[model samples]
Target: MQPIILENVIKNYLLDKIQVPALKGIDLKIDAGEFTVIAGPSGSGKTTILNLIGCVDTASAGKVVVGGKETGTLSEKQLTDLRLHTIGFIFQSFNLIPVLNVIDNVEFPLLLQNTLSPKERRERVLKFVDRVGLTQYAHHRPSELSGGQRQRVAIARALVTRPQIVLADEPTANLDSVTGQNIIDLMKEINQTEKTTFLFSTHDHSIMNQARRVIRLHDGKIQANA
Candidate 1:
């Protein structure tokens, strides 16, 4: 089944009453459990596609369905709930809370969901943290860890809810080459074992190669699908 469906999607940004188009007439579908990479240079609408699929941005003129749910009409609060429960996000910058420890940061989404009690929250968070190989750093704040370690914590946080899809935007932009490769490997492993769909927006060819399917965007349109 299709995990993501975008039909005639269009996105525009308004700057001082001038409408600037970002994504124009996009139609795409991503299957479940596929490692899909949306690759392009800056301003190529790569991130826009990820945002649309992740339900952070609504299209100006089209339809977007995630996990078979039509998102064109969902209110902002409803979209937030959809994202919190069904979608996970990783970004170029590791967006962990500075005030919270590793485990606490991982548990934040669950708190938003209000599903698990404190003990269950702690248990689930630690399980993901350990899976991402950060069990020893659970008590440390974001300031206490290396860049790679922080990214691992972000991975754990993103996956803590057992989300159906993970939307990653330039996830390796801040890391060194080796560290970036390791991060991709870890995500790939999770995608393989957990059957989670990973959709990434990146300019990096290394990431594109790692993906099972690659969609290349240029000039606000998809130019290639491999």
Candidate 2:
């Protein structure tokens, strides 16, 4: 089934009273459980696509439907609810709380959900922490972990929510080559085992090659979809 659909989508930003087009008449569909990459150079609209799919930004025209709901038609509260329950995000910077340890950071999303008891939350967090191979460093703060380990923690945090789609923007940009590949391997493994859809925006050639499907963007338009 298609979990994400963008039809003739357009996005524009105002810069110094000038309207800059980021995405122009783009059409795309992403099937569920696919490991996909949006590959492009800087200013190629990769992040803009991710932001639109993640429901964090609006399109100037056309439709963005996630998990069977049209994002533009939803109210603010409905949009927040959709984002909380259906989407997960990973960033290049490893956006983890410095004060919270690995496990706590993983459990943070569940706290916002408030659907699980403390004990249940702990169990879920521990499971993902182990899945991400961070069980040993569960008590360590983000500052104490290596760059790769910290990104692993971020992965666990993103997966702990059991989101249907995980949108990652330049997830490995900060890591060395070996570490970046390892991180990609981990994400690929999780995508296979958990059957979660992963859509990543990256300029990294290595990552683009690793993806099962690659969508190349250029100057706010799709140059290749393969």
Candidate 3:
């Protein structure tokens, strides 16, 4: 089954009592396990589309189905549940809690689910932290890590839940070119090995070149899908 689908999706934001359209009739489908990139310049609606698929925002019109469930029909609680269990997100900023150590930061999401005992949670968190090559830094705080290491922690945190789909918005923007490329490489390795679907937005040409599929947006519409 497709991990994400958007049919004739439209989105608008209100500014000074004026409706500003962001996405204009977008139609998209992201197959399970595909490494896809939504590429566009600023103000081209890349983040807007990701937000809709991630259930962070609602579409103004049309349908958005994630993991075979139509998001518009879900209640607030159901949406929260779906987000917690089915989707993972990586933001441009690391967004890690300053006080939390690497292991705690990666384990924070699991703590919310309350399904696993402390031991099970620790095992899962350690597995991902090791996968992201942060096993040695498990006890380090975010402030103690370099930019690449911090992003690795974020990646580990995102995947610890074992979600079917991961949505990232400019995840490499804050890192240096070498560090950013390394982050992308790590994500690609995880994508290949775990068969987890990844849909991330970025304007970086170097990053876009790594995607198996590239969907380019412009002026709130799709300009290319290759």
What Cα-based lDDT does every candidate model obtain?
A: 0.91, 0.94, 0.95
lDDT tens digits, residues 181-200, model 1?
Answer: 99999999999999999998
Give the lDDT of residue 9 in candidate 3.
Answer: 96
Q: In angstroms, how far off is 66's CA in candidate 3?
A: 0.8
Model 2, 181-220: lDDT tens digits are 9999999999999999999988889789989999999999
| Alpha carbon lDDT at 121, candidate 2 | 92
> Which prediction has more favorable lDDT, 1 or 3?
3
Candidate 2 colliding pairs: none
lDDT agreement of model 3 with the native: 0.95
TM-score of each candidate structure, all chains considered together: 0.97, 0.98, 0.98
Pairs in steric clash, model 1? none
Q: Please report how far candidate 2 places residue 200 from its true position, in Å.
A: 0.2
- Candidate 1 at residue 101, lDDT? 96
- lDDT, model 1, position 193: 94
- Once model 3 is optimally superposed onto the true structure by TM-score, how far is the C-alpha of residue 144 displaced, in angstroms? 0.9
Residue 195 in candidate 1 has what lDDT?
A: 92
Weakest lDDT window of 10 consecutive positions for candidate 2: 201-210
Q: Scored by Cα lDDT, where does model 1 land?
A: 0.91
